[model samples]
Target: MIRIAQLSCGAEYSGIQRELERAAEIVGAKMISPEVSLEDVMDVEKRFGVSVPSGDLNLIMARATRLVENPDLADAVFVATCFRCAEGAIIRGEVRRYIHEHSRLPVLSYSFTERTTAETLLTRMEALVTTARMRGLLARERQTGLTAGIDSGSTTTKAVIMRDNQIIGRGWVPTTEVIKSAEEAFQQALQESGVKREEIQGIGVTGYGRFLVGKHFDAKLIQEEITVNSKGAVFLANAQKGPATVIDIGGMDNKAISVQDGVPGSFTMGGICAGASGRFLELTARRLGVNITDLGKLALRGSYKSVPMNSYCIVFGTQSLVNSLSKGARPEDVAMAACHSVAEQVFEQQLQEVEVKQPVIMVGGTSLIEGLPKAMEDLLGIEIIVPNHAQYIGAVGAALLVSGMLEV
Candidate 1:
């Protein structure tokens, strides 16, 4: 496999790097970039006696050298530079020269400006990845078989079966006993697909109880929820033609993942509090004498825009809702407010520093709530993409991971 090391500076270049990652994926090369800190740059300048003109440039150069010199880390190097920045241009040249002299690795560079379009960046990146592939830098063995992925989420267990790169069957059931729930879901999927257990090549597991479920099923691969979700989002985006930012709101926790080039770039998760999760919404809905399924629809009928909820604690928020109802607040208005509160918690607390780009992909059980996505779109000013089987995305992603392993 070709592992390409990436070097870039500044938050301004993040979008450009994401586009580069997408391009690399199209050509089957894995990209790995190390994070660089200001202190690390200063240490490099003092230790190596290399004159770095600026802290940003110093950090880029330092990270580049470290990645290039580690044979296990990268097989080639890729650099991105700002178009009109003289300092960036100088640093890129120095970094490239140093890598070529010391490691003799192939280095490909791309320049981008503030006005650079996604198409332009992708075009250049495709060429670079293609060149690396042609030079025999990428290789992989091939395998073929059916695979199963099971996701044992906090409130639900989901299983999916895949064969020949397509989903054959899937099943979902509420989570009760971890082992029983996983087995029930997997059996349903297997029966639907008409595939015997012995025919399955491998099984992969993920989610809150992934370790337990994996052990129970004797799964060959076990992975975290974030990694599998990102992989699943990337798989979905490939069919639609763009990168995706996945927002997964489950029963207990919520996650936000940024996927570029069929891989996860960055992610953030909500705190341990259940205030921003599906369970909170269900509890609040019951207190208001409304069904959880009807909450989203009723919220859309609301005409009043109330103040943001002061507290995100589930207990406090429930009490506040009761108080609001006593003051003649409509049920619809309260429900909409709850949705807004959840969105606010995710954006303001969890994803405070993360950049959320469009076509936002909404997943998990809470994503099925109509008012929640609307509230989120209103807050972020971007359209949300809710896939057909949002709740099963993590399971599908786990299956994809097993498929890749079979090829290796």
Candidate 2:
């Protein structure tokens, strides 16, 4: 039986421990969590050269260190922390590094806050267990047959063709009718790749309109956007050796996905309100009498720092932009301010339940807005990675899924 060492700050969360136990059962793993106390923390700090800060994180690190050192404790380690606590982030990074350097055990990390739902945590824990069981099994023979993946996103439909594990063709179209857009994108890709429909062995569909496309086109595989996006980002960034965080800014929404060992451990999505998504930028650009394509360049030209917009609703935020313009704020300043507002909304609202780690991969059509990634990087204090074909990554990921290269 696989044994997993579960470590956490032990913060008071209503029914969270029970949920963790349930997750272990679902993943077929026996959970072992050692009791941590203040004295234990101090001893670890003194004896093992591990720093113990004055907070709940101190307890978590002490317990985690013991689990890492004791080979008999478990076959894998799982760490949980509160996303809102800055100390938790520090502890998570430190403990993850220590475990990786000291032992060869698989480690998974999760962040929970007041708003974290049980369903979300369970999904991540299951993915972690699946990854652990499948580790070191990535070696596979190259696939020769043609496979295709279609991503019918809210804003655009994208398609890609893969042959011999290489992207032979890709296409995208602004979404109007879901089925029509998907058909167009797929046909374009097929034309470019010169791969006939009869030759394609498998077809996978993903994104918001996945079901619509899957039902209409008879797709062989259907998967959630978060799962496919994680697979795609990891492949595009070539970061399969380590963990990565994928920030995908789509047309109507945004998603932050934490990928541990090529599988999605956890993910967070923007609220129903379109305040923090690509639509916000498009609306704000039109209100400012600038094309959406030019908004990024205009923001970069701003000479003054703009005040952060505080409205949580996109409608109210658009009005605020107009008010700022009426108050003699420069167009460039307002554009920059809108970009900052988008980043603020993502971090404060969308990502309140997840700890964002480095080597962040930015994707989606909204990510093409040059200033948004820069704004996010400035706010997060980390460099952001934008791949060459960021917009079509979901389609690429779907194709990879069809090729049996990544686990769903």
Instruction: Identify the candidate with maximal TM-score.
Output: 2
As a whole number from 0 to 100, the lDDT of residue 145 in candidate 1 is 66
TM-score of each: 0.66, 0.72
Error of 2 at 25 (Å): 6.2
Query: What local distance difference test score does each model get?
Result: 0.70, 0.74
After superposing candidate 1, which stretches have Cα over 4 Å from the reference?
Answer: 1-144, 237-242
Clashes of 2: 0
Per-residue accuracy of model 1 over 70-136 as CA lDDT, tens digit each: 7457766776677567777667766765664466355555456565554544423443443344322
What clash pairs does model 1 have? Answer: none
